[model samples]
Target chain A: MSVEPLNNELINNELIKYESIGISFGNRKVLSGFNLTVKKNQKILLRGKSGVGKTTLLKMLLGFTKPSEGTLYFRNRVIDSKTCWEARKEIAYVVQDTDLGEGKVKNLLGEIFSYRANKEKLDSEKLWTFMRELELEDNILEKNFQELSGGEKQRVGILIALLLNRNIYLLDEATSALDAKLKKKVADYFLAREDWTLLIVSHDKEWERDWMRIIDLETQSW
Target chain B: MPIYDISYTSLIFCFFLLIIPIFISRKIRLELEKSTLEAVFRMSIQLFFAGLFLNFIFNLNNGLLNLAWVGLMIFFASYTAIKSADLNVKKLFLPIIISIAFSNLVILLYVNKFVINLENLLDARYLIPIAGMLLGNALRGNVVGIGDFYNDIKRNENRYLYSLSIGAGRYEAVIPYLRKSLRAAIKPTLANIYSIGIVSLPGMMTGQILGGASPLIAIKYQITIMVAIYVSTLLSTTLSILTSFGTAFDDYGLVNKELYEKSS
Candidate 1:
């Protein structure tokens, strides 16, 4: 508990580790004895069917859900409410449901970037460029988020996560609603960031590239 | 001039007026007759006993006993607020009680000591009636405030998690919700304040006027009580929602599902 966070000078390799994590909803077992180790800059895809707890796994990183069984570690330390707070600063999680906020898209993004940790990281230029890459019109930012198209909302969710300037990401079906070409485009954009570690949960085949490690959670039955 | 007391015969004539609403409900198929009757009967019994008991308490006017009566009011207010919201009272009782009691008591004392300038702050006439006005409004505020807050959080849970994942502290993540609920809570009170004289004569003003006070004095009491109700409500509803945070969520900042009463 007294251990100080490791200095930035050292080689900080380990990113996240799930050691024997398990959870159950009533008597039904969802995930049990789940184990995984994620290292820095290692792009990984988590593949599983619906309701099999793939999203739950990503949520664990942000302390959105607690494991009924084991410990989750970030940077060689156990993840808890406190650690998740710090980890969320460096980790961008784009939920499957991009009903991320209400009101204007620009305002939503503005609020997110207004947090103390992300205050300096709000770059309008970068946001516009990302929007342009995602084929989102400038007017979309002025539009109400609840009124946006599903694909447009997905892109916005991904766009905000990318703009957070974080090195780690957890994307839960983050690109599912996009069309084929746009899926490839979005997948390519994330993959191009070599230093960014990604834990992606998607049924879309666009992300099934050779370079990214795919962990089919179905096979492991975590 | 003093008001005339209604004889039992006059009161019976008043009961005859209830037939209009009952007949209208039956004619229009409004299905409100049973509820209307129940409400009338309940109010009649409640007020009759409350009048008798308050008369006794006013004559006695013991400080500790008066405080105990106010405590009972606070407990009932909290219970009704939580129960009306269909929440598990076990989880919310203490927080709501503490909040309502603290806010109502604080304002009640302030009104007695500072506003009314009474020598005996616990004088039953001032204390009981003033506390009732404050607690009644606070009750409405809590029902809206805490209820709206938790309901919004439950419905749009993903929105909350989205805020959390954006590197927001718990307070920061929950601020939007707090703002939203607080706005919902204060709206009725503000509207009441706004249209106090034009739209309707408030009960306090009417009661004071009928009780033989000068209209000017009645209006003054109305003004002070309105301000008191608004202040107490703001404090109580805000306090209830804030203090509920102690139990509403776990250490992870996720709302405890157990806090809500499960549907039958």
Candidate 2:
């Protein structure tokens, strides 16, 4: 719910716009011609009930799913599977139970840092700074992911998304297991950042205050 | 005179051999008796029919007919490979067929050209049974290879997607699973190869000895057959996995949900 005020310098045109976006799973319409407009540096709260297509909408936006009809635009370009990476390069998504694979946590992070796309972009100092800011200790990264607590895993996922440096952040129940103090700290971290745009899917009322606008997806036809 | 047919009493005695296993299974509360019985019966019937057909084909001694019979064996072997692997025939049948044909032909021709040195390469005595044995082994190996690979990918899909997110191409992402599946499929054959001289005599060498071939000739044929099996195993495993990859994933290299078994 932490809605950072839109910074005038960062605000260019709309970062994303969904025009007549519709999606169906087999016979049922999960999202029916849904539309939303997101400007840069604005925090959007996507509140919805379970199975109301909140996850589906995010996947469609991420190009993992296709809209049966209508269109999606990202930075004024049509968004589809082919061009989804263009938006993905600027977007970071965090979800519960993010699969880390069979490896130590640090190895997973190392693989990401070694990726060709991020080889020149990631710096060791910045990764350490982000880890410290997120309150993640160094030893946790050395342990196997199977040994981690739920909160620790979630934080690791957050750290990964943070390292990606995508300007647009999509958080799907990202803080569900955190303590109230830590939740507020996380909310403030995103809210206080002027260069980031965020769309948050959450049930926590504490986050509501900082969000610029609240969009209730539950009331709409999915 | 009749090429050593089994007597009725011997057939009846063979049926009684099932009694020992059946009693043991019942005492142990094992549920495997039904499948064991069914498999034994099916195998007996199939082999009986195969022997009868081969007797006719051998007597006819026409090259075209012999070739057609070998073709039938390959077709049935490929079908059984698909069935036992529980692969969807429609989606994977073409790749399996192509891989089987490619691997078998490459090894079969190479062996004929260099090792056997028979003028009539398509001779029933030399080609049909040898091709059958080589293709049969390849089929079994591929069933395990392809099945394990697809199952591994399906089970670890989220991990696979994670690798893709970290900027791995599909092949690089899938290499771990492929290595595991190939090793699992080939390990048994490799072990058998190592155990050949020590543990047991191979069926081909034993058969050749019984057929009155010289021991030296029998050993050479046995060695060549093992070599062919090894080469075909390697070729088919690689070709089948790589060829099927094109159909298993979407255009973006993401796995297609429909291509994988629903249960897996």
Candidate 3:
């Protein structure tokens, strides 16, 4: 996992902004009148009950889903179809459902790093170090991802995001399946970076830390 | 000697065999009684008109007319392919038509000129019959290929979306599905080619042999046509998907849910 050195100069610049953003399915309003601003070198936790639009709100930044009402800005530019594709290159997103792909774990990792946007191969030394830290065996890469246990799958997802080395991360329930100890370890690793911009959605109590400010999504409901 | 024509009485004898299915459906509660009769009726009527029109076209022997007939056949094949595959006709019509016409026409003309050594590549007798065989086989292949491809993607949609989420463009993300559907679409034809003489005498070769051609001559035609069908099928299915992809999804890489025909 690559930890980009802290950029004190970028700490105050806005990395993402949501202006009265709202999303709905046909007529059922899920979220509305929501406003949020995330600056560089900030870590924010989204806390909400099930189906209250935490994941949907995070997906809007990646252009996976659109806000039915209000606008979203990334790096001072309005998010649109063209910009969304560009945004994906800079922002690493780990879906709530950690479906990496169906083949071997190492092959999946290989394919992800091979993407033109990835820019570098996976660091094997870092991989082994992180795998040991996350309780994944050296031979785990040989196993099929679909066959891995749920907690193992979550750790792999976290490993890939860190490997991507992007400054911005949108993680949706990324550590929900892990046990308490592993959850605390994963949380601590993410919380260690001072330059990474994290927008995380989780119910895990381990993420409730002093540095990671929590935004109760239920209170922001339309 | 040229093949002898069956008299009208012999035609009656052949139609009589269809009664067995009609009776069996009635006795076994298969509920296929109406469909069995309707299918046979439709087949006979369609073939009767087809025979009459073909007889006229053959006698005229006009190249333009022969090509026009082939164009019409491709249109019907593509139409059947899309409709039976449960896709919206308007959404996929142009691509399927272009794929069917381009692949079948190229293969049919090439076989006539290079394999059969026909001086008149557009000779009505040779072109019309051979094009008909190729179009029929392609129609079946496209139905299975295009049909199975879309359905498989829709079925494993989460897997596809997951790939897209991992920074893959639409083409890169669809590679797995394309590989799978192409394998499925081409397998039956490959089996047909592999087991040619041992498993069963192919219909085209059997028909030619019955029409007084030597076995060697018939087998040669069978070999060329099998190769043509295989290549045409591979191209048609691949092209159909590629071209359809242009309009099948939105810019955000989501499949347009409206592309599927719900009533079907």
Candidate 4:
């Protein structure tokens, strides 16, 4: 009974594992033999120069891009096309480009909430609160998403990620467009959540918290 | 009053009209002389053969032969739609053919049975021509709809991937794209329906009037045919998009890269 409980604890703590991951674009191998393990509630900030496959790593976790070599695991289960969908359910991903089409913000939000996994998660009160927290105006939701400024679009993307209420977050340049103050505020808000696992890819200084483990892709062994 | 056929001499005079466009092309450097002549020549030869074949089929009026001809039309329609949309014909052909055939048949049979009250449902006179109209519209719609859908997804891949990463299922993520493409597919049909008599007299109604039908009878057929064409176009476009979900997307719900024909 004691041994079983310890094994369960260990298994439960390890949220994600990248076993010797490699990514290649054609003949050029951008990333190779990279490995990382993420524990539950761990905050990891991935730093890399452009084209180092930082974004590719995040996408691989969602099965958007498959690793050229090695395997990825989520919650101790191998992340294949089949299991990645389930993994996506528990992960909130804020993409680098926040182009959600030309629809009105409210309609787009409604469409997102209408998904089967997100059906009951849309709370109007929370939406308003988050919007306010994110410095979004009341009339912003009525405006066309494409008409919004880059900062506003980024905030909206972050707002969506927060509203999803998922434990794991893959934030790719999620705050690049935000002003310094808003960026710090957003980073603080995300960092305050001790139980949230964050995999952030950004060049922002605001995300550099003492508790966050920073991994530089360039310095890592290929 | 019998409908007057174009005499060979008058047809030659009609061909003379092409010289004006050829002259304009040369003046404006449009460089379309070769293509224009080839298109006209191809249309004449194809339609000449079609007229002969259609006449033979009408005389026989066998239900099985008419269905086989309709099947052949569907096959060519599907092939053209895929080719026009720049999709791999081998991958998407089966689903597209099935969708076009199903939608056209359903609307055609319903029109024959309930609207026209035809004694012979598969009579070549009705089946072949009606099928041609329905299949033509559906083919155009499918080209627009399927092409827009896959192209939109490809262009805005980040948005689509964002949805998937946020816990959306394949259908959920694709619903927005589907809605947009379906609207695009049916927009022309809707415009044609609204602007029918006001903008131009439709070919079917004009043909019927020229063939000695009363204006009132031609207008009635025009209305029914317009409604039938609209319904079949919408149905086929919707079914084509849905059915293509099987082959166009892989197990990961990502569009198969191989589904697109590589541009030379």
**Which candidate achieves the best DockQ against the true structure?**
4
RMSD of 1: 3.4
Model 2 Cα lDDT, one tens digit per residue, B1-264: 123556968998998988998998999989779988999989989999988888888888788987777777777877787778876766777888888888887788788878998787777777788988898789888899988988887787766765555455557678777888888878877887889868988998887777777889898998899889988987887788888887877755576776656323
| lDDT (tens digit, per residue) of candidate 4 on B1-264 | 888999978999999999999999999999999999999999999999988998899999999999999999999999999998987888888899999999999999999999999999998899999999999999999999999999999989998888898888999999999999999999999999999999999999989999999999999988999999999999999999999999999888899999876543
Writing each residue's lDDT as its tens digit, candidate 3 over B18-82 gives: 78987888889899988887888899899999999999999998999999989998888898888
DockQ, all models: 0.69, 0.28, 0.48, 0.84
What residue runs in model 4 are displaced by over 4 Å at the alpha carbon? Answer: B22-36
Q: Count the clashes in each prediction.
A: 0, 8, 0, 0
**Runs in model 3 with CA error above 4 Å?**
A1-12, B261-264
The predicted structure with the larger DockQ, 1 or 2, is: 1
Ranking by TM-score, best first? Answer: 4, 3, 1, 2
CA RMSD per model (angstroms): 3.4, 5.6, 4.0, 1.7
TM-score list, all predictions: 0.92, 0.80, 0.93, 0.96
Instruction: Name the top TM-score candidate.
Output: 4
CA lDDT, candidate 4, residue B159: 88
Consecutive 10-residue window with the lowest summed lDDT within model 4 chain B: B255-264
What do the candidate models score in CA lDDT, each in turn? Answer: 0.87, 0.78, 0.83, 0.92
Q: How many Å off is the CA of B251 in candidate 2?
A: 2.6
Clash pairs, candidate 1, are none
Error of 2 at A77 (Å): 3.3
Docking model 1 quality class: medium
